[model samples]
Target: MSGEFGEEEQIEEQEGPAPSLAQIKHIILILSGKGGVGKSSVTTQAALTLCNMGYKVGVLDIDLTGPSLPRMFGLENRSIYQAAEGWLPVPVETNGVGSLSVISLGFLLGDRGNSVVWRGPKKTAMIKQFIKDVAWGQLDYLLIDTPPGTSDEHISIAEQLRFSEPDGAIVVTTPQSVATADVKKELNFCKKVALHILGVVENMSGFICPHCEECTNIFSSGGGLKLAEEFNVPYLGNVPIDPKFVELIENQTTADESLVESYGKSTLCPIFKDIMDKVLAQNRPARC
Candidate 1:
């Protein structure tokens, strides 16, 4: 019975209206075929940039067991609250640009080191419940950072946001052919599931020397744009490796608020803005 249509899928099989995400206008799920490709970074940067543009943005970290957003946005000690519906998210702000709210599995845990030992059924069910429970007030955009690969987490988000039809997913990748190969399958999976793709972003495409301030292709180049052309999806843009972004990561863990705020206008800001422009451009003509 567990082969395909099993008894455990009764929750999904039952006829029920999807939760109303009416408060959030656009939901963009960010994915990568493999981990360590900086998908979460891109997701956070995009959310911050969009919020900077005067849009109310919320980030839903669906990474589940390995949630990094709490530390990434400096909300490690944040707590969740009770809402009329369910648990409410804690708003995190930085340099006047921030999310309306953010919800991560980290906030619900007792300690940062505590493990979330959830299996498939339980994890997917939690995803469903979180979608129904989180009280993300009126938001212009909600960026969902998914665990790498086209698996349960990705499927859960797609199913939950089916009614909204999502603005689209932004795939992140490196300039390596190996990464692009995996991303190709991820792109096809999205196509098969009928999720529109905003486009693909090449991260760490080039490295900028902190001293010389010169850009160099450290991971080869053009693979992301090439893959987009091959798949006929838009090539959003690329982000070069910057020391400022590195500082952002380091300060996130050490609680260096002053340095973190100053780095908000890091070199990555301009690059992220260019990519978000393409995302908004594509997001505009579509609405469900």
Candidate 2:
């Protein structure tokens, strides 16, 4: 069987209704072949950008081993509750017209320091349950923040989401050659699984000086664009390492504003807005 199931089994699975994902208009996965490439960061920015555009959004953090969405969105103290239908995701406060909600293993853990040490079967079960049991309600966009590489977790996610008609993946990578090499494998994995690639996003492409607000290519640049060209995929754009953005995540605890509100004031807001604009335009329904 290919990863979790044979081709015929995959078809049979997709024929059933996806309860949790039914009302989600568009589903996008933020992926990476290597860790520490800021895949979750990309997911966060994309969700915030979509919310700012007045589109209701949901973020599913399946990076089970290292669920950080709770801390990033300043909802670390939040917890998930069991509703009659399914698990209720915690809603995030945003100043925009749209709403944002999230579900992650991080919120379910009794302690933040606990590690998820599970075998393949257990992890696979959790991934499937996350896909089927979360009550996401209606969402204009559902962005899944995935762990790095093509492991069992990734395979389980692909198998479960096969029928949901995910919009596709946004591959995140760094400009460095080492990162690009591993990210190339992720591109191949997507092709093997027949997952349509929406585009490639090069994160940490440069460093934005906090003082002068000038961007310097400290890590070099163009590796992501090169990969996109080599693989014949669209290069969405590059995101610089903005210290202010880091401060934003770190300062979320003390800040009086909601994470969304705080992010709306960030300089990176315009950058991601432009990038997500490309995504929106590309995903726009073709009209007669």
Candidate 3:
């Protein structure tokens, strides 16, 4: 099946007025072909890493039905203020690493577990307003955490955002073949939509034994790297399955140095740094 919708003309005509895209340096879409691949975790880490590096960052949680960024960053109770023109994003600080402006349907719904029983068009409308109406002032990076699978929300954002070229996307997956198969579909979706593939991040690639300080290939190692090589894209890195990490997420704790050292074996910070380096290098304007 094709990724691009044939109804672009109708959408363009009926979208009311197109929103102005400005002051956004890079738009990074964190996506996956299937659910439960830790896509949101990867997105949260990327945003936090950028903030730690002294860059202004904003995260747009486009996962309307299941928003996790707010909870992950400890901003679930936060509220957005309403100005005359549009809504103002609530900024949350992470370990003195600048501020993170966030917008999610969960914020609007006021209940994390509330179901959003809207259709595709309604979802598309909300996304358009989130991108256009919200005031994301002078952001170095805007990480958009999208819902899994190629759906209307995904297509709407891909078509609407004017990035000069294709905005880069990071595909998240696990080492399991089922997850890899879905990632292939996601890859094809990105390629079909003309979005640049930043890289593929393999989450839960292995289990790091805290007792023995040895790594075990719980799911199998190097699947993401091999897939990236096969597709001629970059291999971002891997994040081990740590029980403590799971606990942190369950308890809505930020991934600061303490948490990283506790569970990540001093690897989370470095892995995030490397990913940021690659993202910045890729986003830099080509030398004339």
Residue-by-residue lDDT tens digits, candidate 1, 1-288: 255666422213323434546667788889889788898899878877887787888888999989998877778878999967777888875555544578899998988999998888788988888788887777888889989877778777777776665788899999988888899889987886778888999988988777797888988899999999999999999888776676676676565463335444677888888999988876454332
Off by over 4 Å in 2: 1-14, 211-215, 284-288
Question: Model 3, 114-202: lDDT tens per residue?
Answer: 79998998998898788788887777788899899888888888767643333589999898887788888889888777788989899
Candidate with better lDDT, 2 vs 3:
2
- Span of ten consecutive residues with least summed lDDT in model 1: 8-17
Query: How well does each candidate superpose onto the true structure, as a TM-score?
Result: 0.88, 0.92, 0.85
lDDT at 63, model 3: 91
Quantify all predictions' global Cα lDDT against the true fold. 0.79, 0.87, 0.75
When 1 and 3 are scored with lDDT, the better candidate is 1
Winning model by lDDT: 2
Sort order, TM-score high to low: 2, 1, 3
- Give per-residue CA lDDT, model 2, range 1-288, as digits (tens): 265664422322455557778888888899999999999889999998888888999999998999988887888978999999899999988865699999999998988988889877898889889999999888889899999878888888888887677888999999999999999999998987788899999999998676797878877899999999999998999998877877999998888988788888898999999889888878644111
Candidate with top TM-score is 2
